[model samples]
Target: MTTKTGDQESPLASQVDPQTSVSRVPPPETPAAVQTRFRVIAAFWAVIIFLGFPIWWKTTSIYRASLPLEEMVHWADGKTCRPVFPLEIHLSTPSLPYIEAQHLLRTTQHTLDDLNEFAAHHLRLKLANDTTGDHTGQDSSEHVNYAARETPDTALTVRLLPQEGLASPRSELHAATTQLDVFYPPSQIPVSSSSNSPLSTFIAAELQQLYGEEKATIAHILSGDTARLASTSPQLAEDISRRLRRSMKYAETYHLSFSLFTPGAEPSSWDIEAAVNEYVSPLLQALSPISNFTVDTQVQLYANFAPTAPKPEYDESEAVWTLKKEGLSAFVNAAEWPLNPSIGTGPTINFILYVPDPSQSPLVVKENSASSWIVPQWGGVFLLNPPLSNDEQGSRSNPAHLSLGSLGPAFMTFSHQLLTLLGTPSTPASLPLRLQTSIRIRAATLLLSASSTMGSLARLTESLPSIPIPATVATSVSTTLSHLTATCSHLREGRFGAALASARVAETEAERSFFEKSMVGQVYFPDEHKVAVYLPLLGPIGVPLVVGLLRELKRIAAKRKAKAS
Candidate 1:
């Protein structure tokens, strides 16, 4: 075994290798190339920061309009307006002289002031001229007739007459008009020396009695505390609460629908036009100043009761068919009844005149044995058991055409129900006076409702930071505030009609603001969802850019270190 020298082994190794036996090492990159690469990276980052990021942000951001948040909150807090009622009562004393009448007016006002406890609602008395064609107190009847006409801003008229037959002072309130007839003995008239007299005391007490329920109701509505109102009786408070609950919400208009429903087919035609024209048209006209009403009537046959409704049973003792009181609630078959609300902005009031089948004639509510009942806010129902037609087989059948006379009682009941549903006070025995009361009640209700809506909107905005309020909501808020202010001014100036109109607008605007569609709609995107959606695109593009940036920064740091060394 001979070991070869290292030089000779290297020659053999070189011959064994391929033709290219030499390995070459490349030179370092030039500064121009390094600067070009760094510039490319910098340009990419600049585009991302200036253009790409802004586009993404603009596309994803929500659009929120500017709002007067502070002003809205203030209005909601009831800091914007306070409501006050100043009722003007006109005194027409045709019997007394001018000086005596003025003295009586002053004394009565003083008496009323002393008796009244609630300051917000107080009465003001003004004397109406008793000049009815010459002699005073000579034509008392003519004077009363003249005074009954529509007096401007007048709530009530007092007609004083001196009667020789009267033992004591007597007061009679007119059921039709806002007039009070006071018949007194001539001796009871107030003299100049007497500050307090029997006549003044009587008038004061009468006025107090007239407005007692109204004052309590106003107080309850304003404060919502019945216990604090001293004049409110338990029964009165319960009545007020029931009326409020049963009454329909205040509206600018109401659609009154008179429908005749029957289980059989005989009573298909009715004198509805005549009935509405005679009985309902007058009432609707009377209520026109408060709310506009559209009258429509219909007749529906083959209308059956719901399955859940209790079946009417024959009362052998009373000889009539009767339905249980609790079952009256289900008398109207809501599922099958064609009682859809009228096409309008306001609500529809349905007056259902149900005529039971001849077999179930004389149907009445079991508890009260009554033929009429109110559905509380919805409308009213009247069971009319028309006399059956006589036939050879003695089979019972309703008449084909109902007369105007037959519909009188039903329509009257409907009118009363309409009044109740409109939140009219039960007292005062005057339609005009009751309407005025309704105006005040409706105004108060609208004001409070708007205030509550404003507060709710404010709280909602505070609670939900993500919801984007549209400019419409701000516009609605501003309108509501302006109308509320106008309403307060109208009430103060005794323009109740205008006040009601303003309150209606305020309520409508507040509701619009609170229930704004855009403000209510909010699409919530969770952080996890955001990450899931963005990660796929960002992950692919971000890693390379970040790594390149970090590597470039490290290289620059190393260069600085070398230069320092």
Candidate 2:
């Protein structure tokens, strides 16, 4: 009953009882087995460090290219290009003797030099060939080519005509050509002995007056303040500021889209081809030397006003539908109207010829009671209220097709708006002269714009250290710098047209570099996303490797202690 006193058991029973039998212990590890485990662990770490880690790094890393950051910043700071405009004015003395003409030129040059305070924009008077003839009364075609060939950058030509009827010198600027006519009384002519004469003084005064605004504008743009560079009247400064604010940015090309918009079904077609040919083609041709233009036209029906737009109301005093002057900005139903910009590298100018519904007939701006107005850099808007159709119901509807004659006035306004939007100066009655002035203005504007853009890009890179800059951005920056340098050189050499072309390239490249899609896309990857993607794989693999490394280290330390004992 006592089970033979627990210790007194048979050999077989003792063997069956696991506690009394010898315990099964694992054998000590062989040197080869320990070496094999060590090799396996080392292999795992080697694969991680040399292969897996490198692959992950290559896949996840961003690509950045070297850039000339200092150079770009310098260009933006206006430290690189100090723009100088040495305008060359040709003096044509058809009536004066050679020595007398030279004497007048000397005296006038001295007077002009004395009057000019802006050294960068001073006029350089040069004598024109006598054979070019008096271009004052003649057509521009008669002398433009000859003058262009002889003197490449002649801003204006002064034709001296001695008249018996004139008591004092009277100057006239041609409306089409770059010629200025000075009809002088014979007595006002400068004698060889006289250092200064009335004619020279008059010419100097007229020249100053003609270029006064231009000088102010250039100075304002260069110095960023007219008050700092020269003494500019408040009125002139205000006008310049207004014009600059209203003008469009400089571009290599401009798309002119003339659209006929109507809320109703009528006025579905227009003689836009003929209208453009007659009114806009010549101006575009004249502007071809500075920039290219693409002309297109369309007629859109059922184009209603936006929901938030101000509706025209009947004016009691004028007995017409009138829109408030303040609300004119929202007159164009941009949401409903198909005023998409023309597809091109340059900007698209939209000229909307809106035909109001019969209910809002004779719609005009309330304050001025005008039918047309310029929308700053956008375009122009004109309200055309066509006469009602003669029907049994007497429905008020616009004509299906607008004739060229009917479209003339609207197109004329559009042309003038186009000129203003292109940053053409209002002064100087000559069209060619205005175009030249526009060229200079555009050049100056583009140069400053590109410089500013470069500065902005440099600052952007410095501010956002995590944003990856691509090789294309570096390439674009280089191209911009090179073209900007070329533009400055061209301006210095009086090649304004060439300068504009180069500046266009520089601006395009600069904008492209600054707005690169890839660079922008790289900046938005969040830290949460990175952790979610990497933690699962790294956690499992790292724990085992670290534990194995620690166990091996502990074993080696114990072995060294045993050896030391």
Candidate 3:
């Protein structure tokens, strides 16, 4: 019974012990299995290292094209090109012999060179081919037709004619043409032997005076040295600076939006088409050679000023409403008024014709008592004080409709202000001359502006190394530089129109390159942000592969050591 009981306990104990026993250590891994595990890790790492990384790098890499950074900076610093104005003046000596005319030209050129303080802007005298007759009293139509065929480089035509009763030589500038008529006594004409002549000296002096302002202006622009313009009148320097400050930047086209704004409900409509045709069209036509303009007009009623704007106060002495000169800056209620820029390319110039309520019928600037004032780099404003009419309620009100005749003065003022806004010079009185001067000024301004843009773009690329430069931006930069070179060449050859065209293209391209959307967006995306984005996937995958590679390497080293021992 004891033996049977012990055997039963032993079986139970064996079963219980087996159930509670720790697991036995597994046999050493097979060489084939270890080799297989190593191959798995190697294959996994091979796919990631050789295939995945290459694809990621190819897909995520930023393409940065090469740029001419040093050249761009040189252009901005005025080292690549120095602007020069070589004005060609045609000398027409109808009354003098050809030899004498040639002599006169030589002497006059010598005198001009001596008198000129600015070398870049100097006059060059050339004998006119058609010097057959006196052009002083020529028919206006004939002169105009002749002028149309003349070379665009010809800045002026000097007609030297012998006048009987003149003791001293006198000169007259044609108002409608670029011709100068110099009336001198026949005795003043220099002989072939004479090295110097009074007539040549006089001509040189007149030409010097004629171009004094332009010379000073160009010098100021090129050098920014006021001392170059020391010979110029103080008024001229002031005018140049003022014009530069007030002028709008150069553009190929400008949108002219004429809006009639009023504080009352009356004067809701005006003959804008007729008024523009009568007053503004001619000036725009004249300015067509230099710039293009698109005209649009609208009428806004019950357009009140901003509450923050200074209201016009009634002046007891002047018997009219007056706006303080200092307060004129806040006159335009930009927030409330519909002064949105025109929907098109180029800049929009808003000309506001404001008609006050009947209570403040006649409003003017307080200081000068002028009815019009210009907003610099923007537009102009004119206060229209229409004659008050008695309504059904016996209350004075502005007329419901303004006729073309009533809008004449206001339009005239607008035209004048338009010239001022377009950077038209006040001197030389001739419209054609002023326009020509404007061409040179505009060309210089555009060239400088484009160069500055190039420099800015170069610096931007240099400062932000991670920003991707698109092929489009590189193409634009190339285009801009090429056009800039063309512009410089044209300017040197005195082809003002071509220079202006080329400069316009350069400016456009430079602006496009500098403002490239792709380049701009990439600027905000940094490398650290990219790393943060990729860390989660790379961390787990990378750590295991690295550890497996190290363990395999260690095993191979141990096997070699064991074999050596």
Q: Which of the numbered candidates is closest to the native, going by highest lDDT?
A: 3
Error of 2 at 307 (Å): 6.0
- Candidate 3 contains a number of clashing pairs equal to 0
Per-residue lDDT of model 2, residues 376-440, tens digit only: 98888988877767656876666787888889999999999999888888887778888988888
Q: After superposition, how far is residue 408 of candidate 3 from its true place, in Å?
A: 2.0
For model 2, the superposed segments whose C-alpha errors exceed 4 Å read 1-27, 130-152, 191-194, 229-231, 262-269, 300-321, 341-346, 355-362, 385-401, 526-532, 550-565
* Candidate with maximal TM-score: 3
Candidate 2: residue 119 lDDT (0-100):
86
Question: Could you give the candidate ranking by lDDT, starting with the highest?
Answer: 3, 2, 1
Identify the runs in model 3 with alpha carbons over 4 angstroms from their true place: 1-26, 130-152, 389-395
User: What tens digits encode model 3's per-residue C-alpha lDDT throughout 1-565?
Assistant: 2223633554445546564476766799999999899899889988988999899999999999899999999999889988777888999987777878888899999999989888778888999874454668779998887665444488889998899989889999998889999999999988888888888999999998887777777877777754655688777788888887898887789999999999889899999999999899988998887789998888888999889989889999989899999999999999988887655888999899999989987888999999999999999999989899897999898999999989999899999889989988776867778788888878888888899999999999999999999888889999999999988987887778778889989999999999988888887889889999999968987898899899999999999999999
- Give lDDT tens digits, candidate 1, residues 1-565: 3446855555456456464556555688899989998999999899999999999999976677666667677766777777888888888887789999989999999999999888878898888874344546647777666545323366788888889977889999887888998988999889987798898999999999898888888888888867776667899899988888999987888988889999989799999988888888898888887889987888899999999999999999999999999888888999998997655778998999999999899899888899998888889999998778976788878999899888888989888999998989998787888888888888888988887888888888877777788888888988998898888887776767778888999999999988887766573653567789999979989999999999899999999999999
Cα misplacement distance, residue 336 of candidate 1 (Å): 2.5
The deviation in Å at residue 167 for candidate 2 is 3.4
Model 1 per-residue lDDT at 501:
87
TM-score, cand. 2: 0.84
In order, candidate lDDTs are 0.85, 0.86, 0.87
